[model samples]
Target chain A: MDAKETVMNVLKDITGTDLSDKMDENLFETGLIDSMATVELLLNLQDELGIDVPISEFDRQEWDTPNKIINKVESM
Target chain B: MVNIQPYGTPEYFALIILFLLPIIIGLFNGRRFVNYETLFSLVFLVLTFGGSKWQQGVALIGYVIFEVITVGVYARYRAKQNNTAPFVWAVIIAIIPLVIVKVTPAIEGGKQSLIGFLGISYLTFKSVQMIMEMRDGSIKEFHPLAFIRFILFFPTISSGPIDRYRRFHKDYVQIPDKDRYLKMVDKAVFYIFQGFLYKFVLGYLFGKLLLPIVAHQAMLQRSAFFHTGLSLPLLGYMYTYSMYLFFDFAGYSLFAVAISYLMGIETPMNFNKPFASHNIKDFWNRWHMTLSFWFRDFIFMRFTFFIMKHRWIKNRIRVSQLAYLVNFLVMGFWHGVTWFYIVYGLFHAAAMIINDIWLRFKKKHKGIPHNRFTEGFAIFLTFNVICFSFLIFSGFLNTLWFK
Candidate 1:
């Protein structure tokens, strides 16, 4: 799987909800993930992806939407 | 207790100059900002502490001094190897003060001043947490000076989201560009004024006017209409408190971010529309977010790890329940050392544990078990439950069971 696939897979595991296409769905707003789950998400993204995302990237805009997070991850 | 310079004289002017100097400096240049944040914070330590509120200032200074020393120990350890926690030492130092004030019964005239220790509790935690992160190698090894600014940075100096050293270090080092710095300064100034509006205006109105009036009529006289009337307004006041909480905290966070921005340091956004949360768990995640993150990372993460590692509480109640109990209790204690705070945390933990059980029960089926209206109803109930817990936590709502 590509980077996007990896991110999507991670999100699915995280939210227990499908996000095959709706990448812009606001994770917190749509009940996909709560703040507590965010800790898991950050940890998983780092451990699974081999990418140590600085917590600074975990801002509202960047991490709010699936697409945004993927965009942030790709850029990093 | 936000040390507002009493409305008069040179002190007010001095405070304005202190805040303004940064803004002016920002517009002109962003160089020397890190130094400024550290220098001004130190100046704030001396002048503001020694100014009108010398007692509180001195206490803040003492904590800052202790936190610095503790962080230094961690920094020294890092020079040799990873896996040390200077914050552990600092927390011990902090607990000394917490015990005297908390353990001593008030009847015998215990430590009479919460104001003295106002900024110390939060700052000490922030300081030590950062040190621990440094030892854990989560954050880049910080210059001892920059770490000091991270601890005593004045924007969130009064009440805080309990910023972590790693987060602060991350933000500090990764300032995007000159334009980004300028944009942050703009946002930061906006937050400073916004902070003023929330704390003084909205908060004062709710606490002084709305809540007081309703609390008076409702408590003094007993009638359903009066009770309902008082409760309804109190709900509105709760929203006010919610807004007050957001603007007050987010405002301060912006100032810190902005100040740190001018210093070319990044700071995390503490609030992310938490009141819009539809669940108990979501609210905790959004609200007082820095505090939430701190408890999760340090207390909850560490405690849960320890419990599981040691097999401490193996009552067949499921590990999830244990997680909830420990998480909430620590979260409550993080808010303050008071009994009210403990109950407040437990209340949240219980509600969340129930919410989790409900989710698991629903998970037995397929997607979309509840209709939108039903979901909305659940969200409403959850929100109120949380608001009520916070009200109790704030020590405003007093009832026999709550204690």
Candidate 2:
């Protein structure tokens, strides 16, 4: 699977809600994930894909969407 | 020497406006008089800390120097290395003064710590945040002067809408254009007026006037409801004190933000219709937002990550529950090392855990109704729960039961 699929799967595992179709939607605003889930997502990303997003650098606005998270992970 | 508490009196507001006039004009003309602003902040700081509060002034200076050294050394150390021990030590050393200030009163039979000054907690929050961000490599440089300015920015110095270093630095460096500055001024005026209504008018009504009567009545009923002090007057006191707490603090916060805006810094707000919250979690997001968000980010998120990263807790639900307990317990201790405060923290932690369980259950059960009526009921339930929590927080129960 690609990086996007992996991220989506991780997010689904954490939030118990699929976001494959709503890639650009804000996870926080939509209540799909919160700070707890965000931390979990970061950890899962590290374990699964080795993308270590520091909690300090995790701006909710910048990484609010699934696509944004995928892009940020890719860039990193 | 004249001493002035920031936004303490109507005269303070008048004096601030008169002094801020020059900065306002400078901003209006697309210029930021940084030196003048700095001088203004120093003068206000001196006014606040000088005179009868000279001891606090001395303590504040010593405290600031200590923190600057600790954070500065940590920042320097973090530049080339990434050791968890040093980072933990940095956080501990930075909070040492605040911890002393908090614990001294508890240990010394309510004698205030000499090292404790007004806004010590707020200052420590900012300092610790800087250290944490530096550890994360988010803050690459630590300028002592800039850090001092951020710590003692005077407007929100005493109590904060706890502005972040990066956010404050951005606004401080960039002078808002005339249009944006003008809009800011408009908002500032509105906020200041709203502060007057909340603080002088409504807060005065609830806090100064009604609170005393209700408190006295509640005290008189110390033997009521099976000596549990659970009287109607106590209930009255709860709702009344809740309003007083909200208005008084929210008013002060509005004044802080309004003044920050006049100085061209967009300080984050502290309140957002907190009573309308539908759950404990939502209430936290709305009420004392900066402080709660600070706790959420630094304590809750950090603790959760630490636990998970260490694989100490396999169950995510239990991990979050533990995080909430620590977060609220620390918050309670920060309020003071009192039984009521600690119980208040535990109460909120319980509320949050229960709220989380309900939220999860709701998510699973599609049969659960979630319409306007249900939403309103949820809000009403949350409001009462919060008010009851505030009563526990007020320490009146201590007076009724122990005193």
Candidate 3:
């Protein structure tokens, strides 16, 4: 699977909500995840997808949605 | 004495109503009359600071001048260049007064600091936040008058539902339409009544009446010990102190917010059914929300960034765990440099860490039924844990431990 799919799967597992069609929707804005869950998703991305996102660069506006998370991760 | 402390009694409400009536009438007629609002703010500020507590008044003036200059100078410097060293120094100097205030009592056998004033912590929160936002280029302009108005906004100066600089500025400059102003009036009236019920009635019952009774009883039985060395009346004191703490602080917060709404500023709410929290992390989000958010934004987020940028730790979990410890430890120290307060902070830090572990465990073990009963049980557990922490925070333990 691609990094995006991997990150999405991990997010779904972390938040226990499906986001297949809501890829572009903001995770926090849409209430799909919270701060703790955000930390979990970061760790999951690092462990499962080998994308070690520095928390410093993780602005909610920029990496808010699944697609945004995927884009940021793939770029890294 | 003709001096009055702000919101100290119901009598003060009459004066507030008398002064604000004109401003309200002007707003309804589509005129803001900023001068009236400014004048009333100064008058109320004087009432709060100009009484027997005039020393605090001097400290407040000196403190505001220092912060205004520090933030103004820093913003100007940031506008010219982006350098870490000077920004760091500016931030440190801004916080020096508060640090002295917090530390002095601990070291000097509980004597208050000379520079200490009421609401120093809240104002410091606002100032430090402004400096950080300026460094981030979020606060682009720093007008001296607007900055002063933002910091000295009277309703919340004593305690806060701490408003943001930009948010306060926007609200300050705009004249809410008649319809919106009326709606604000409705909410303001309701919140003021609620504040009376919360602060005057329930807060009096719990804090003024029952807390002292239970506390006295608890002091008498400090000798009893269980296997964990816990005592009986101490248990009673736990629930009593927790209720008193909530009612008193929540009442003050309600009054503050209600008055802000009266003045047409949408100051945020501080408590939202915090006892209903299912976990320690959720509790923090609900309780003293603005203060916690301030800490989260300034201390937790910045510490996380600093840690990650320096690569001080390789493991993300360890990095966050350490951040939580440092964040809460500073918060505890800020409350006062005492053992119980420090332990209270450490307890919450540990509770949140354990809560994370439990969440991870729950995620792995699907059989651990995700149902109402479990959720209710979680809430129950969290409530008691928090109450016990409040018991420690009440300094009854200090009476039991050392006295």
Candidate 4:
């Protein structure tokens, strides 16, 4: 799946609740992700996308959304 | 102080590794499911109650003895009392040890060893909850091994999620299948390692790096902004608290949960999406839910029941209001005997009650009155309320405020 699809899918899976729009930023505030769920998300990305996410890359900005996480993973 | 410190040094590591000697034998013996908890407790006994310093060993021995006798007797006695008062009695009796430990001045006259309170605090809470349940007839037969394991689970021996007895009993008997145990182990390994990163790496590193600056600034009182700015930046440190607490406690809880799972038991979920909470009420509902549930069951219910029976007052404030007051104060006091803790709990109780009222009002009024301004304000208010509560609960701030 592409970045957008990946983002939407991960958010839906993690939150188990649909969101209003594209998963860009503020996933934490919007209740789409949390600390534990973020770890889960990281694991999912690693398992699914064949990307190694450095622990340092898991700041609020980076892990806030699938697009951001995807971009970070791709950059890595 | 019992001369044994919580911070494990080289000697501690050596002792711990050495303590594992028996388990190593158990390991070689094809230990077909050795309860690591029982072994750890024995190790702890060897280290704390049966080790080098006679005084230390005596203290631990005394501690274990007291727990076995008072809490032990209470557990058995409450199993027949068949009422709510036994729950109260157990809690009171449980906290007595904590209070004694906390109030007793260290022989060294230093603050380092708040011996017995933290671990035993957790121990007693679990024990008390168990006894009350047995009394209430919630648990029919108790496994002595599982009970010991539940009490002395080493990972959470430091901090805890305030696990209750009913959950423990339920989980212990319903042991997971082998495949599930392996899966839990995988998750446990991840959590334990991840928790180390969060607590030791992210938290301790930041504290070591910036603590000097923060302490120095606090001491100098350089300027108004200096303190707030230092503290704010050190929100990274505090964020580590949020981070550390979640990972550390969650990891530890997962450790116990996974281990318990191996032996076949499903403990209550200690955490869900806590920070994902939309409101303060939502936050409590998600965070430290075991403790919240216990307080509701043991404290809140009793207080409300008492008030209702007496018809304490007319519908002016509601029995629920009084219940919150007592329940939260009990919660705060459970943390410590300090005034700040008391106030902290009271604040939360009021906030929760008000939030409930607001929710009720909103529901009664009907329709989602979506106002961007109101929603933003609500978020800001909720966050500030939480922050201020933390400020009150804060270690340094509480001392400073008291001073």
* Candidate 3 lDDT, A22-68, residue by residue in tens: 88887775555766466667667767877766443456788788888
- Evaluate model 4 with DockQ and give the value: 0.02
- RMSD of each candidate relative to the true structure: 5.7, 1.0, 4.0, 13.9
lDDT value for candidate 1?
Answer: 0.62
For B1-403, candidate 2 gives per-residue lDDT tens digits of 8888888889999999999999999989988998998888888889999999999999999999999999999989998899999999999999999999999988899999999899999999999999999988899999999999999888998999898999999999899998899999999999999999999889999999999999999999999988999999999999999999999999999999999999899999999999999888889989999999999889999999999999999999999999999999999999999999999999999999999999899899989987999999999999999999999999998998999
Compared with the true structure, what per-residue lDDT tens digits does model 1 show for residues B1-403? 3345321233453565566576456534534465555566566556545655767766665656665666666666677765424446545764566455444444435446553455655665676576556645666565767766676666556666566665666665554556776776677667656655655566566656666665554444333453433455556545555555555556556555555544555555677677667677777777767777766666665554445446675542355466778888866665656778899878988987888777766765667557888878877787778677766665655441232
Q: Of the candidates numbered 1 and 3, which has the greater lDDT value?
A: 3
Residue B218 shift from truth in candidate 1, angstroms: 2.2
What is the C-alpha lDDT profile of model 4 across B1-403, one tens digit per residue?
2445332333553555455555434433434245664666665655443434555455544655565565566656655655666656766776676766655543445343434533666776776666655554555566565666667655345456566555555555444455665575466446545545644565455455555455454534423463443445345334433444455455455444433333344455677766655578667767777777667656665455445445565452465677778888878877766767788899999998897677656745768586977777776677667756765665555433334
Q: Interface RMSD (Å), each candidate?
A: 5.5, 0.6, 5.2, 18.9
Q: Where in model 1 is the C-alpha error above 4 Å? A: A1-76, B1-19, B26-30, B33-39, B78-110, B113-116, B140-142, B170-176, B222-265, B306-317, B367-372, B399-403
Of 1 and 2, the candidate ranking higher by DockQ: 2
Model 4 stretches astray by more than 4 angstroms: A1-76, B1-37, B48-57, B71-91, B105-118, B140-146, B170-174, B222-269, B313-317, B371-380, B398-403
Cα error, residue B240 of model 4, in Å, equals 6.9
Error of 4 at B49 (Å): 6.1
TM-score (C-alpha) between model 1 and the true structure:
0.74
Q: Which scores better on DockQ, 2 or 4?
A: 2
Q: DockQ, in order, for the candidates?
A: 0.14, 0.87, 0.16, 0.02
